[model samples]
Structure formats: C-alpha cells, structure tokens
Target: MLHPRITRVALGASVCVALAACGGGGGGSSTAVGGNSPPATSNAQITGKAIDGYLSGATVCFDNGQGACDLSQPTTTTDANGNYTLKVSGDATGKQIDVLVTPTTVDRSNPSGAPFTTTFTLSAIVSGATQNVTPLTTMVVAQMNAGKSQDQATQAVQNLVGSSVDPGADYIANGDSNTTGVAADMVGHLEALYGNGPVSWTLVQATMNAYAAVGNVEGVQQSDVNTQLSNMALSQPIAATAALADSLYAVDGDLIQESSTGAVVSPGLSPVRENWTLSGSTLSITQEVQSSGAWSAASPVGSYDGWFSGNFIQNTAGLGAMLMKTDGTWTNWFPNSQLHPAYALSSVGNNLVGTDPNTGDAITASYRTIDVSGQPLSTALQIDYRNPVRGSMSGTFPTGTTAYLASTQHANDQLMLTESGIGTAQSGSWSASYSPGTGVYWSSLSDPTQTLTSVQQVVGTQIQVDGPCLLLHIEAGGVAQIVESGASGCNYANEPISFPVAGSWSVYPRNPNVITISLPKSVGGATVPITDTIKNTINAGGSLVVALVNGVLLSGYMLPASSVSTVQQFPATVTDTIAAAMRAAATNIGETQNP
Candidate 1:
C-alpha cells in the first residue's frame, strides 16, 4: 500500500530564560486633583529605568489570576534611556508580582542562557490608585550563553522521521556499550565520518539514507514517524504537481486560501490535483497543481503529476510501508527511511500532522485501514488549486457622521465610510478583491474642506490608509497612486513650488481664520498677503483632520466650520489669527517625497 513516511524528534533539555528587572514604583501625582475613590479591582503600573544595559522591544506583563502573564496586552516601548512604564492591571493592591522580562528574539552571540529576570512586589496601596513599591536593584543585565554544543541535525532528522534509534546512555563514540544494531550502525557511521573532524554535508546525506532505509528494512512501524519522512520526499513532487493542476484546471487554490484567511501567505505544496487507486498489498498515488500567477492574474500557468506504488507491513509494533521513487530507488515511507535515520518504529507510529522543524510545511495524515479482507490494495491521487477568499472590511467612524454616503458594501451591517463636510469626520475600509473581472476600491469624498485620505500601496507591505491615522490592510503590492476628484484641499494643477534654500515660504492660507502675514521676498515670487479660502474639516474634539500643505510649511490648526459662512471669503483678522494657531500647533511640513 502507498504509505506515508515516518520520523522522530528529540527535544534538548537546555532552555534559555529571559529576564527584565524594573525598579522605582513610588509615589507620584498627576496634575488633576481628586480624592481617593472606593477601591476597585484593577491593574497598577510599574515604572522604572534600567541602570545599565539595553532592553529589546519586549512585553511587561502582570501575574493576574493566571500564573504567568502572556503578551496579549498592550505593551509600552522603552525609551532610549531604558525607562519604561508597564501597566499591571490584573494584579490587586498589595499583591506582589515577581515580574520577569524575557527577550522574544534570540541574541545570536548567546543562545544557551537566559537574559535576566527580576522580582518586584506590589507592597502598598495609595488612596484611589494602585499601590507602589520599590524593587531591590538596578543594573539589569541579560546573561550570555555559556558554551554548550548540541546535536541539532541528528535531532532534526529524528523529529522528521519520528523514530527512536535508542542511542543508548551517553551516545558517545566508542564509549557507551548500550549502543548496537541500527542505532550502533548509524552512530558508527556518524563517528567514522565526523569524529575528530567537522561533520560535512556527506554525513547529513548518510543520515538521511539511514532514516529512509527503516521501513524497507523491517516490520510495521508507528504512524507519526512514517508521516514526517513521507512529507519531505513529497514536497517537491507536490509543488510540481500543484503547478501542473493549475495549468490544466485554471484554478489557483493558493489565492482562494489567502482570501478566505484574509492573509497573503504562501500555500504549501499539496497535490492540487490527485487521483488514487487501491489494489491488493500495493497502493498507487498521483497529484499536480498550478505553479505561478498573482492573486488576480489568471492566464499563464503550469502543472505536474507523478505516480508511485508500494507494499505495507502490518503488525503490533506499528504499520510499515514502502514506495519506489521515480528514480527506481526503493524508499520506506513508514517505520523507517534512510531519508530520516535516527527514528525507529516505536516513535514512528505516533500519527499526528505537524510542521517540519526545518521547513514549516503543514502536512496532513490520519490513521486509517489501508487494506482489508486479509489482502493488500493499491490507490491513486489528484488535486486542484483555487483562488483565495475575500476578507471582511471594517473601520471606526467619527461621531455625527454616517457611512451611508459611501459607495461600498459591508460584509455585515456595519458602515465602512463617512462624510467630508463641516461637523463631520470619517475613516473608510474595504476588503481586497483586485481582479480584472471584479471591481476595485475607487470612490471619492467631496466637501470643500477635508483633505482626501491617502492610501499607500507598497510592493511588499500591506496596503494602508495614511492621513491623521493609518489603517493597514492584508493586500499590499503593485503600482500605487493617490488621486482626488471633486473639491480637494489643494489644486494638483499647480505643482509644489520648490525653494532653493531651507527657509520658510509664504503662500495663501486655506482657511479664513489665519490672518495675512508679511514677509520679504527671498525666493520664487514676491511676498504678498493673498486672500485664501480653506474648506477643510476638523474632528469634533478640535484637532485638524489632516495636515495642510501651503508653500513648504505642513501647518496644523483647528477650524470650526461654524466660524465661517459658506459663501464668504477670508477676512484680514481671521487670516492673522488662523496663522498664529497653525504656527502654535505647527509640526514639520511632512517629508517632501510623494506617497
């Protein structure tokens, strides 16, 4: 019967711990004044600065009811000076928490030991806020890896084959007497080839061959071990086959999966198209799929497919099977295969689908009766690829505005757009379904005042909406363009005037609130106070909805639509006041590069 390959993995006992020590959790006062309210169940804050050493972007968690805190909560970034403030909301007042910080990323120079972790207890409770306590020491530092060598390659092969060759106690060369048989032979080979010297690529090949020889050499083996080996041998063939299936069927399953999951992930190589047949003690399998094209591009494509049949060995130790490769070489898919050596039958039978430790591939397999009626059987296989599913669009809308005026369909009842005129604000969202046959997001918001929201489409990053805030989407790539139709903040016809020197340039104000300013002509045109009209909108709370571009200054200001009548022009008094306000809230004019 056509069976899957088996492999095993041995986890090392070494585990590196990370530590984050914080101090200084004493009394502090906010500007606001209020009496202590009733004690409420809540989280507190731990604020401190590291005396020495730097901290990576790691999370600071509290031991809320859970024994250990997870990275699900929002974490603050540490400043350049190593100062940080972590909100420990789940812990109660007076309840001490032994907070330990762990570095999520490994420090290449040191991998064996943990960085550093410190303990701090919540000692006292302040009137209405969380209690504060001071930690013992500072000089927080991460530990370095104390030199220790591990056999990762051998362990990886074992994991892949899901078998245990019983390396015996202290699997050292010519030292341990427990090693013998297949285990001894494989060890001998490794020692002969690697002892007193560096292990070369040849040793890896020899290890693989030893693993692959398992099923062909003995009786039935475990299911888990068999699956791993089988998966490795099948990856390339699966990719080739899936590519072929897409060519013939005109289906791109990768795209379909992406759309469904709302993610742009590379799909695994499974037979996009497969056919199966079963006969006596042997089984045959074949499969194929499409190899190329964007989520929308549907024309050019390719496909591949192959066949194989093998025998199965059934017994208590486990189920074993063998298959002949396309090259006429015999490979055991179950129990053992030279492809993955270290594992044996006992470890191979644990049938579970998992990803490869080296190459993350979602492999699948299940325990099933491949044969019955006291006889053997054979089978064939095929697969087809399809497009990705579309994701749901969602966003937050400013109050007093509705999504009704927008032209887009929401997956549910929620709105995805808003208004652009006075007393209004908006944010928009839409799913990615860019295809030649389908429509793309192309709509405009017109209200004289608010700047058109800019959506950036970079080649590799996710698509994102940029303005006052940024909204990232799953689909990002290809040529990017931003254009506004109808009433806009600026006239595109008049390109941005460049200044030879890095100084200020005078231009007309968009709103009547800014008072005209006087300046001597330095570059470009002569300085003059021009009566300009701004139709921009503002958030109800009084922040500019978007930055205004005038000459070279990226000015910000709060413009109350109520301040001016629709038909009136800017007065001298309004212009002067508005300019001052813009200057007060002024930040950089923004980078010169176009989005």
Candidate 2:
C-alpha cells in the first residue's frame, strides 16, 4: 500500500456581495463607525451565489470579535436563490469577521457524506450591505472529498480558485484582509523552500489585486473541474512510469557528510555525473570516476517495481553490483551474496528524488532521459541534483546540496572541464567514449601550462586515462578530481615540464558553453591562492566555440568519421582580441574565485 503525507494550511478569503431591499426602512442609514469608537450595531444583509448557482438553504456561520465563528452570534440560511441576510450585533458590527459556509447536502456526489464547508473573512458589516459569496464556495465541494489527501485537496482548491475567478482582484476589491492573509501563507511556504527573501504581505496583496481585476472571464465548468481532479489522482503514476521505462538518464550531484546540528562536517567535493539505463524492467547504472592516475568503473543493477504514487516509482528488489566485464564479458564478484536492493524513485518536475525504503533516507536529485538514437552532440542540456546525506543521526540526512550536470555529447563520446578556486588556476578536463558492442575508452588532460596527457583501456569496473606525460587512475562511479599533474616521461615536447593543478570541472545541458574549467592561482608564492575559471561555449550544432573568459578559453571540435582524426587539441592561444583581454586581466587572474 502507498502512503502519502499531506499538510493543510489556512487559505485566504474574498467575498462578493449583492444587496436587496424589501421591508427595510427606505433612505434610513446608520452612522459610520470610527476606528477608536465603540462597536456599533447594524442589521446587514449578506448575499451571494453558490458555486453552481445561488446557494439556497445553506447554513452561514459568522465570527464574533473573538476569532472563532461564534455560532451563538447572529447566523442565517440562504434563500432559494442562495441569498442570505444576517442580523449583526455586538462587536461583530465594526470588526472584520470570518464566515463559514456549509451547504445543506454536503456530499454533492455521494449524497450521504458529511457537510461541505468553506470559510471566508469578511469586513465590518453596515446596514443594507450585500456581498457576492460564490467565489468562497467554489472549492467547498472539492475540499469535502474525504478520499483525497490534504495536499491534493489544497491543490484542488487552488486550482479551482485559479480557474473560477481572479483571486488577486477579487480579494482586493472585496477586502484587503483576505488578500493579506492569503499572500502571507503563500510567501511563507515559498520562503521555507528556497530560503528567505524580501517577501512582504503588502507587496503580495498589491500584486494579487492587480491580477485579480482580469478574473476568469471564461468560467470553468463543474464537470471539467472534477475531471481534472480525477485525472491527477489516477493518471500521474502511470504517466511518470511510462516516461521512466527503457530510458537512459544522466545523474549529476554532490555527496557530503553533515553533522547533527546541520553544520558541514566536511565540505563536499566537486559534483559527479553518472549514467543510468533502464531496459524493460531491469535497470543498471554506470559511472566513470578518476582517482590518482587511473580510472575505474562500477555498474549497480536494480529492478523497477512500478509507480507508487505522486512522483515516486518503486524499485522492488535487485542486487546492486556490476555483473558484466568492461569488455562486455560476464563476471560475478558477489556470487555468494544477494545484490538485491530496494528503493523508491520520484521525478519532481525535471529533477529526480530517490529514497531508501528501509531507512527512508531521501534525496532530491536531477536527471534527464537520454535519447540514444538522437544526436547527443548537438543537444543543450541542464541536470540538477539534490544529494541528501545521512548525518550522524540514526534516520536522517540533515545536510543537502544541489549539483548540476551540464554538457553536450556527440555519438557516445563526451568532453568535460571545470575550474574552481582563485589566484593560481587549478583545473581538470577529461574525455570519454563508449560502444556497447565494442567496449569503453577514456583520456584525461590536467595541467596549467604543460601539454601532458594520459590514456588507458580496461575491462569491467577498472578504467584508466593514459596520455603523453600524464596518467590518471580512475574508476566508474568514483569522484573525478585532478589527482596528479606534472611531467611523467611520455612528454612529446621532450623538455621536462610540469605545473601543479587542482580544482573541479563540469558540463551543463542548457548552456551553449558545454564545459567549465576552473584553476587556482598562487598569490605572491604558493601560500595564498585564488581561482580562475573559463566557460567553453558551443554552437547550436553542439560544436565548441572559441570564446574568452577572463582572457582564458579552451575549444574543441569533432572530426568526420571517415577522417583518421583523434579527439585531441593541443593548447593554443585564442584570438588576438581574447589574448589581449587575457593579458589585461593577467594581474587580476587570482583575485577572486568563480562561484
């Protein structure tokens, strides 16, 4: 069984009024009460239409000055046309009061269910005042559905408000109190998610009022509203699951260790990117990680257990280790142990959320389904991840951070570079290509001035990038950082040369600039350091564009398949304009690091 948690927050109110005079005195008016004056008494007629039509025979409860809707206070029932006249007395006369509208037949569909209720805040009532209250009751029936979760109900109400009327203008024209309260609640929720900002009630109310004037001119039908709610409840899981099947997704994010008090115990390393493939009911994830002067690989296998609810997809059980060799050969490292693991995956918008079913450890990550048949080289992409780490607590990963995987790929090959810090430039770059029928290949180039390269080939999880004067140890599903940089003999230039380099690199999807390279510069000597970063822009066709970043740039392109050209480009100066900019900014190279 699937369980969903929903939270209910108070909603703002807006009232529409209509007035009729019959037995009331003609041309008889009551004195307007002042702010500080004692409360005045008045017999007010509150009238409004219901959602579908006039709310006749509906019970209306009004609030006194004490906050709660004091049923003992004056109340009334709407006439056949959904019109109600209330007789106000005591403190309720001069103060804004809350009104709860309840229909006689609560269950519009079931007929036997409990009554449906809707609340709205109305201002001080004067004699002969009429208000349209249809907007308030629009969501009453939806909220009354006992089968839906609170979140779903609230969302339904919000949708109803948006579809039926213009909340901004309606609330403002009716009264400022309703607008203020509603805006407060919405802004509060936003602050909790993306951190606090300059959110104020006054600003919210003004914005809402401005938009509400252009209300829902094309009124929504009750049947359409019900259909939308029903569709959302039943079709979300099926849609999400269909989108996930037989897809290749790229994962990019960070891994960190945080303390119980929500402080960073250790700053996370640079972000990592991995690829996952879901073939039918089985799923396998592969990652290439560089460590020291070598590269390695890892493939964790799992199975899908269909959709749970909302955005979540369940993974029933599966072993979590690679069973195939990097050369497409078979190998069983965990022959004696069950590699099956269970978890849940959910996609919230464009991002992916994964949770540990056993421990309930959840992470909000991001991924993009890869179209293998499409031209990968020309597509601009953006990947986001929310990595939730397990803290010192028993069942919590209090610390979380967002990471991005932005890059352009061609065929089955990719090149990525990123820079971090300031002063002395510390940067790293790597390229990889894979063919399922053949195997996998990779290379790396990490140095400030020297043209040192490393390349390697391996079968299974072990991988390497070996090049002239450079050799890096790496593994699939491992962190990629510049582990070593210097002259290591394979120098094509022959003159011994080396420069220590460090930092991080990554590729973005949406950005035309596919790669980011960051390097650290030494201040004075090597004690104080700063960072210099460069972003390599790409054309719409996914080819690299030579552009300057603080006077530094790196550019690469692909060669035709018929040509005997390798994916290699020696270090070269950019255009004179860019070269001049680099010289001009040379003195300020390590002043500050790129965030």
Candidate 3:
C-alpha cells in the first residue's frame, strides 16, 4: 500500500515540552529581554539574531498575521549588533513562531550601516532556545507552509542551492561562513527583484515557491543566487509535491546478503516496509524505500550515529545517552552537553513520536524485534541458545531528534538475526540491487495473496513478482527470469522479468508446512553441492514465498504468469505511496526548476 515517501535521516535535534512555536514579522510584541523596559522574569525564552547583515536596534517579536507582533506575546529590540533575547510568558500555546524583524529608522547593520525600511517575515521552526531568522530559512518555511513536511522542504531547497547550504539551520551558530555569505547576498538579490531594504518575507518566500514549482534540477547547482534564480522565469507560487530529488531517476530493490557483521546494526536491519506471510515457515520482507546513497542523514549540516542496544540509545556522535523508559516516556539527559538546547520524547504504540517540544510537530521512529528461540540461524546448524537474540530495525524520525527502539513488535517480526563470536556477519548490505542480480538474489511478499489454494497446480507454472524495483518469473526446474528496470524510478511492469536458477524444488519432509528452496552456489562456474534454506517459508496464494540474505532482505510472493492480466493483482506501485512518489518522480531532480 501507499506510505509517506521518505528520505534517509540522521541526528534528530528536538525536545518535547508543553509549549508550541509559530513565526511572524513585526516587532511590537515581545517584552524585550535586554531592551526597552526590563519587565518581569519570563517563564520561557527564545533567542535569535536577524541576519540581513545583523540588523541592530531592530524591533524583533513573534508576528501575529495582524501585521505586528501579538500584543499578548513578548517582544524585544536587537542590541548594537542585532541580537535579541526575547521571553515567553504564560501558557505559550500557539505563540506565533513566525518572527518579524521590523527595522525602524535607528535599526541598521554594522559594517555597511544599511538602514532598515520594511518588515522581514520568517518562519521560525525553532525549539527551546535559538530561533535565528534569515531569508534562506524563509524559503524553507515557505515550502513547509505550502504543505511539504519539514524534511522534504528543507532538503528540496538544499537540492536547489548547494549541498552545503541548509535552509533550516542557523549558519551563524553552525559557523557556516559558506552559507552565511549566501544569506547576506540573498537579501540584496531579493530586494533587487522586489525593490528596497524593507523587503517583506512574503516577497522572498513567493520567489522561492515560484522556483520550486519548476520540478527537477537534475544536477543544477548554483552557489550564487543571481546566476541561479535569474535563469528561470518563476511561475506563480503553488503547492509543491513531496518527492525526493534522487527518486526520480531510479527505484530498484537490492538483495544484499552479507559475509560478516563488522559494525553493529540491528540484526535484520531492513530499510523497507515488510510483511510476513508464513511466520514460522519462511520469512519474506519486501521493502519499498527511496533508492539512495546508503540510508544516511538527509541533513547537510549533521549526520546521525547510534545503536539500539536493549532500551538505551547511545549517541556514538557524543550527544550521549537517551534512555527510552518502560513507562512510555523518553529522556534526553546528555549531561554537560550544550549540543541540543531543548529535547523530549515519548512512545505511542510501537512508534516513538514527538517533536520540537516547542513546535508540536509529529515525526516517527519505529521497528520490530523478532523472536528466534526455536529457530535455526540457517538450515545448516542449530544454535544452542542461552543468550539474547537481536533482530533488524528500521523506521522514520526527525533528522534532529527521533530514534528507533526495538524490544519487539506484534506482527511481521521476521528476524534479521545478527550472529557474533564466530562468522557473525551474514547480513551486510554493501552491494547493489541492479539488473544482473550480481550480489544476492532477493524474494518478496510485496503484494501477498493469502495463496494456499492448491500447491500442486502452481508448481510447474511460470510465476511473476512485482515489488520495490523487483520483477521476476519463477521457473520450477530452471534459473529465474528477471526484468531489467532501474532502482530509483521504480518504473517496472507487473509481470515476470528474467533469470534461470537450475534447482529442484520440493516440500520439506520433516515439516509439511515448509519447503526446501535449494539456492545454487558456484565457486567458479561449476555448481557446488550446497543448499541455503531460508526459515519459515511456505506456499501462499499458490506461489512460493521466501526471503534472501547476503543477496537481499526482501520477502516476495509468486503469482502465476497467466493471471497477471489484471495489473492490480501484482501492482506496479503500492496504493498509498504511488500518488506521492509518482508526482515527485514527474519533476526534474532540482528544486528550483521543473524538468
């Protein structure tokens, strides 16, 4: 079915507090922390600087759509260097996070001494402490306001600009002089387009949104805005579809059965949505995720590193330990670390969901830990179990804060067992999932049909599979026939592809519910006498459902080729994720212009 089309993620930086955040463009609101009159000590505070050359003496406050900061909310004025430490009082629910930078006559920049004339609006997706405002982030927020998720919007713009420019980050704090210079130049360029220093954020945002409508940029990287935004005739801004830049070219399925477990990941760490048809018979997992550079952080400014060991998640990147409690609540007690200003977490069902403790946006992190007590690591040998077994884990979380927890799950818990001590690395995914099926052969249960109708009738027939970038035909006594389609676009048909595996298939004598899929092994060109039997495999919908490791981590099902006339039976795209994925695939690779 259809799921939210996603990109890879790393380091999530957020906290869960009671308050929420919004953005604005006026300076009449906040009770300025260090300016105007020192009122009372505020309950909450938000700090930031206006980076249009650092507007000093500028009035900064949470804008309320009313053209000014809400009188009910707090307000402040930037010091000599354009820095404002504002306060939040009362039940800070729905406090306009849209920061408004109103430059009065006295408000001016330092070196250049440029005078402020108009209001600059910016969407402040800020959390606990810092909420820096700039024209670049306004572009990101414009995309967010148009309906794309934060990650999608952030990355889309990043693709538009250079990979080094992050629209959602604080360049000043991150010390990104590269992007900081880009921000400085952006204001002058936008003002040139719209005319004047009193440039409204709306003008800047509309300009960005207009460019985003162009669809794809394939490989258009313009570090300078004048050269980039100048080339295209931007259309009237419209809502952008949520598609990743890489997903447009290819969408292929990979079968990577590893030779060893070098570094520790979840045992069976599959990066796709999986389904289990025959739990104890054979484990099948067909995952459909964006085909990209090994699922890593989508953020240009940061990357993520940690392991799901029992309950605690240790941030190998020095963020320290995040303890996920049994009481359903989570804690980010990184003692003596000022890395993340605000952070909080809690679990909902199998998912660990939370957001900008201040913004209240919902992101996710989830996984299933399989139970393999009575199971064999493979059909070759049975391990005498006395220790804890681990399974593979996968899910989505904010690039800044969300993390996965894997004690176990209710269904589809086919284990991706990680063996250690001796020859313990059988599930590594360092190969490719291309046309030749070079590394490992993968099977799928992508569109399962509870097929157990009659095993005898389906045995000698040709069967086809359609899942991820997977497409193939199953032959009873020969090599498999597979289809040739790229992995990123996922534009394959619903039919048998190609391949020829010469092997004799038969039902297991010991367990009537299982069967032996004697996968052929060739040391050179000659066939070797050995069989790799996957666990818990069975006949469902009259087709063999099996899984592959080292070669792949998918659980595919077989459908007789004759019945493939109905496209829906073996769908080209899952119902839920297709609309979004296809819409994105239609656009070119870049964010500024459609291909």
Candidate 4:
C-alpha cells in the first residue's frame, strides 16, 4: 500500500486550516456527493494553496474573471505566515479563472522555467456564504531546477530596460511599479558598468520621470521619491527590489560595494555603504575599492549609481528616439539628436560613464556609460582663434589676458605681431606655445629663437608684423609716425587716382615713369581706346596700358604716343601716351612728370 504526504501551506488572513479537498485525495479524504446540481449562492469563495521551490515574496492575481487584479497593489503586506486574503466579487458560474501566484521578488523566465500561472474552473457556488476550501494543486518551479537570485533579477531588469524593444503591455501592466523602481536601481549598475556619456542627463531624467510615474499609482510618497533621488546621487542604485521588500522588512541599509572583481551584488539588495554625500549638485564618491580584481590603476570603472550634475531639459531636447540593444549598442532615434555636449567619461567602481554640467535646468547631475571601445581618439577641440586677420578686431575671448594673434593664413616663417596702440608702429614676433596648464598657445614676442612657452592665453582677431620698414596708411584714427625709413622721404599729396578700365590694375612706378594697367576679361584684346577720368592727381608718375589676352598678361603698347608733341600726344588713350613718352625719353619720364 502507498502512503499520502500531507503538508500544511499557509492561506488567507491569519486563517490556516487543514483541508481534505481532492486533486487526488487518496487517504482520509472528506466525503463527497457525486451529483451535478449547482450550489445555491452565486457569490462563492474559491481558495487554494500554491507551492514553489523558493518564496521570498509572492503575489496572486485573478485574471479573466476580475481582469488585471492583483492583491499586492490593492492591499498591504502578507502576514509573516505568508498568508493573504482577497475579497474578490465575481459571479462564479461555469467560468474558467486563472489564479496567478507570481513571485513578486524574483524573475521567473531567466532560468527558463515555465511561467508560473495556475488556473481553476469553477462550477456554480453550492455552499453557504462561507465555505471550507481545499488544496487546488499547482506548483511553480524554475527551469533546470535553478534558484532565482536577487542579482540575476536585477541584471535581467537592467537588460530589459537597456533593450530596444518595449517591455510589452503585459510586462508593463504587470511589472510596472516594481519593475520601474528596479530600473532606477539598475541605472546605478549601468553607471558602474558604463560611465555617464554625453547624454546622461536625458537618461537620468527619463529614469527619474519613470520612477515617479510608477510611484503615482503605487501610493509611493513624494518624500520617498525625494530620498531615493537624493541617495542615487551618492551612487546608491535605485532599490525597487527593496521597495517591493517594503511589504516584508525595512531595507534601509547598504546594498552595493566596490570589489576588486568589479561591482557585485552584496549579500542583500541594498547598498554596501552610504558614506557618499552630495552637495550643491556635485556628487563626491569617497568610497574606494582597493581590490584590483575589477579595475586597476590603468583601467578604472564607474557605476551609474551616482547623480551627474547637469541640465536635464537641455539634454532631453537632444534626445529624440533612442535605441539600445542588449549587446550594448546604442544609437539615437534621430540623426539630429544632441545631448549635453560637455560630458566626458569618468569612473566610479568598475563602471565607466560620463558627466554633464547642467546649465539650463535645475542644478542636478546626470550620467551615462561611456562606450570607449566604440569611441574615437580625436573627437573635437575648442577653436582657439576664429578668423584671424591682418588688422584690428575682437571676438569671443578666452581666459587670462587679452590676446592679439597674427592670422594663421600668413606667409611662412611669419609670426603674430602686435602693437600697444596703432600709429607708432609697435610690433613683436609670436610663436605657438601652449598655455602652461591649458589648451592655449602663448606666442612670444621677444624670443628670437621662436621657442614657445605654455601660458594661459586669449585669442585676438588681428596680429600684424613689421620687418625692417613697412608702408603705413594714414586713416581716420591717427597719423602715421614713420619709423626707421630706409627709402627717401615719402611725399604725401591728395592726388586724384583713376582707373583706366573696370579691370584690376597694379601700379608699379618704375622710377615714376609708368603704371601698369591690368584689363578685365572684357577689356582684354579689345581695340577700343581706354579712357579714364582722373579723380585725384597721379602721384607724380606716368601710366602704362597693358592688355591681358586669354588670361595671359600680354606686353603691348595699347596706348602709344602719337609721335607728336609730348603734352598733346594721343590723350584719347590717356595712359598710352604716358607709356610711350617714358619709352622714348632716354632721360627717364619720371623726371618730367610732377602731377
């Protein structure tokens, strides 16, 4: 003869009773009536027991009959005896109902077990208002007979959030509050794994928003939200697990610790230490992991466990659609998305991430992981000087002192030269030297060796250089005090200048005898007499007319003298007579012209 095993399973609100109900009741079973008659009352009680391998926390829900109904969301904690009572109102008449007892604290699908859901078809209620229910046999077990661990569950949550696919309506509807809270906690782990990227503010702000939304329906208080956000700044991963455990025990202790092998799950699901502090939007992590297991002096890692002080609004503006794969390949949904541009990678424990300096939104820190392997070496650098020219100018300046730079688009071996003020011809030579401690180059004016010295520098719009003697043009501002002139004194006169044609002309006064005329494409090779109106005196020099044919400078006598009188020779081609006179006079024409 075989024996029947009878064990007690807790059910109801402090109501534990022994049942002889039958799934396959063999020995000492209660007497049953073998009839198909329906019970009197439509409102009947259906109670059962669920057995599982591990049960740190569990919740039962009634689907189909009561829709998405779970006892956990609507009620408080189950007693220490693991017993719960749900006052469900339903018409129990030939309807199949699913009694789902999901493990609230563990992930079921990770170990590849059949999903835990139990169903029981109820006939008509035939008992009194209250009836004795018995064991409805249904058990949940993991695949490969594996036990679910807290860290595995946490990792699963992280992977889910980090995935591009949506959590699905079922996961969101069922897992919501607890799951999102878990996601917030998992961000810390990601921070540990991947330091804050340039888009950390968007990631963190989205996380905070999701957590807050989850809290709204779960009756989580604003105070709790405040505390959790504050703690996250100190590298504490969000404890959605602990929050679920709220119905169990108070988990207000440490859950994460720095290990040599990298960030590992502590004994429980709380932070390992809370020694970190946040002040004025700055997060300071004083905890050190001395073990080289996870990271060394060369390769350090960080956690997303802390708050990255940054502007969330500006960051969010740059985040359109985002795609993150389980394999950690992430890309923006839109090609135009731009986040906090000033973020850089940093580490916490064994994770690498980036930090954003918040300038628009509230003083807050945002962080994300840095994919270093996918990153390039030379990204971008600040342009020291923009548009350096040969004259006076200014622009968005750098730090330290006002800088004046010679244009980079200059002749080779030339240096940036400048004066205290204009007119006196004060100038100096400049070479490229990096700022002593910054990314600026300090050009030296006195050093002839051209050796550069690092110093904090400012960018100037114009830098001019004077070698030996330079031609000075007197403009509206000041008079030129010609210094160290090697040539004879320059005679200044308001002589009118004229253009023979609309083309470009270069005036090279060879002993003041002639000026060269460069004709435009239209005037080139044309036989028309070139006439010019003199607006100013011709600086005591004669002029020559030269033609450019087919883009080539052709030497010609386009305006030759008439071989008559010197003064009245072919004024029709004004400069032609000048050139012919200079060619004819053995005594240079520069001696005769004084206009």
Off by over 4 Å in 3: 1-43, 90-95, 102-110, 116-118, 164-168, 197-201, 211-595
lDDT of 1 by residue, 1-595 (tens): 1101001111111011112111122112211111123344354655543211223333334323221234555345445533456665553333322233232321121223333211111111222332211111100000000011123332332332245322111222233222212232232222222112122111122223323322121111111111221222211122222222222211111121122112322333211322222222122222223233111221111111111111011010111112222232223222211112111111112232233221122222222111011100000000010001100101211122100000011111110111111111122232221111212211121222334332221112221222322211112322222212223343435322221112111222333212112111111111111100111111111122122221111112232222211001112232232223222222232211110
Q: 299-379, model 4: which lDDT tens digit per residue? A: 122221211111111111111212222222223222111221333334322222334322121122222111112111110
Per-residue lDDT tens digits of candidate 3, residues 1-595? 0001101011011100000111112233321111112233244776766654455655566656532455666778777665778887643322335445444423232333343323455444443355555555565555655556657776766654556465546555676655554454334333223222233333344345534442211111111111122121211211111111011111111111122112222233222222211122122222232333123211211111122110111112222322222222223322212222232334433333344332233333233111112111110011101001101101111122211111112121111111110011112232122111222221222112223433222233332222234333344653343333355766434322123334445543322322333322211010111111110011111123332222322222222212100000011232123223322322322222111
Q: Which candidate has the highest lDDT of all?
A: 3
Per-candidate RMSD, Å: 32.5, 26.0, 24.8, 37.5
Cα lDDT tens digits, model 2, 1-595, are 0001002112221221111100111111222111222333343444333322223454554533322345566666656654456665532332332233332422121222323222222222221244333332222211322234434433443552443233212343344443333332332221221111121111121112211211211111111111222222111122323334333333221222222112343442222223343343333344322223222332222111111110001111111111212222222222111223333455333434454332233433332121111111101111100011100101111122111121111122222211111112223443322111222221222222333221111101111212223322222332223233344544334321133333333442323333332322111111111110111011011121111221233222211112110010001111121222222232243221111
Score candidate 4 by lDDT.
Answer: 0.21
lDDT on C-alpha atoms for all candidate structures: 0.21, 0.25, 0.30, 0.21
Better of 2 and 3 by lDDT: 3
Number of the top candidate by TM-score?
3
Off by over 4 Å in 1: 1-44, 47-75, 81-83, 89-285, 291-364, 367-595
Q: Score candidate 4 by TM-score against the native.
A: 0.17
Q: Which ten residues in a row have the lowest lDDT in candidate 3?
A: 10-19
Q: Report model 2's TM-score to 2 decimal places.
A: 0.24
TM-scores of all models? Answer: 0.17, 0.24, 0.29, 0.17
